[model samples]
Target: MSIALAAISILHLLDLVILITSTAANAWIVDGDLSADLWYKCTSKNGGYHCKQSINEDWLQAVQALMVLAVLFCLLSFVFFLCQLFTLVKGGRFYFTAVFQILASLFVMSGAIIFTVMNYAAASSSYGYAYVLAWLAFPLTLGSGLIYIILRKTE
Candidate 1:
């Protein structure tokens, strides 16, 4: 259980890094200059769609901040799980940890979905494979939450 949760934590951190990089192109305080833009363009091509974007710097930053908070919440939930693993009985309040995780995952997913939809609405643009990883994250997170529920009440 610990190993599984640890792996999940690591994956969550990695996803956060990717999410941050994806936003780098339009950071208000860290403008995605020409070189950075080119990098995004190149990497994006590998992902099955044009990854390059022209987002409003402030909007991009705002989105990043929101997602970061979501990730932090996930981390917090994991921390709670860790505490319970060490101190609680097998089934004591596991549901609470799972509930927090589920809520956090839902928030992150909604944010990502909203961001994608808004991006399309703003520019009528399409996203490609780079988004696959993000899309993949949603289910993984949800799965984790479900795992907690399954494990709950187990002797």
Candidate 2:
């Protein structure tokens, strides 16, 4: 039980880290010296990088909001999990944590999907590691949620 608890905690922490990285990284799309993210568009020039605020597109804004929400929900879920771990009755499942985590996963999926569909028409660049990390976080968060649902508090 202790091992499972520790593993679940680790998974949740990992998901949170991935979510933060994907949201903040300036490499959602990359082509040669050009890279773009939710917040900025950057290009390598001479020996330095030039960056500017991202264009205000509805879809891009939606993606940005969704990603931020995903991070918030994941953080909230972790807090709830810790609180529940100590106060929840034996055999009580981590339903609140699971629900928040599942919502976080959905937000990540929505953001990634929106970015993929909308960005397809905007640029011919390849998706970068940050984009891949967003997709990766979706499944990990979902799996973590499912695990939480199945996990019961035990002495």
Alpha carbon lDDT at 45, candidate 2: 93
lDDT of 1 by residue, 1-155 (tens): 55665675676566455544433433212212222221233232333533454455654455556566656666776777677767777566567667766776676576666666555332333444335444555666666677667664333
Off by over 4 Å in 1: 1-62, 121-130, 153-155
Clashes of each: 0, 0
> At residue 18, what lDDT does model 2 achieve?
99
Question: Candidate 1: deviation at residue 68, Å?
Answer: 1.4
| Residue 5 of model 2, lDDT score | 90
**In model 1, what are the clashing residue pairs, if there are any?**
none
Supply candidate 2's per-residue lDDT for 121.
34
TM-scores of the models, in the order given = 0.58, 0.97
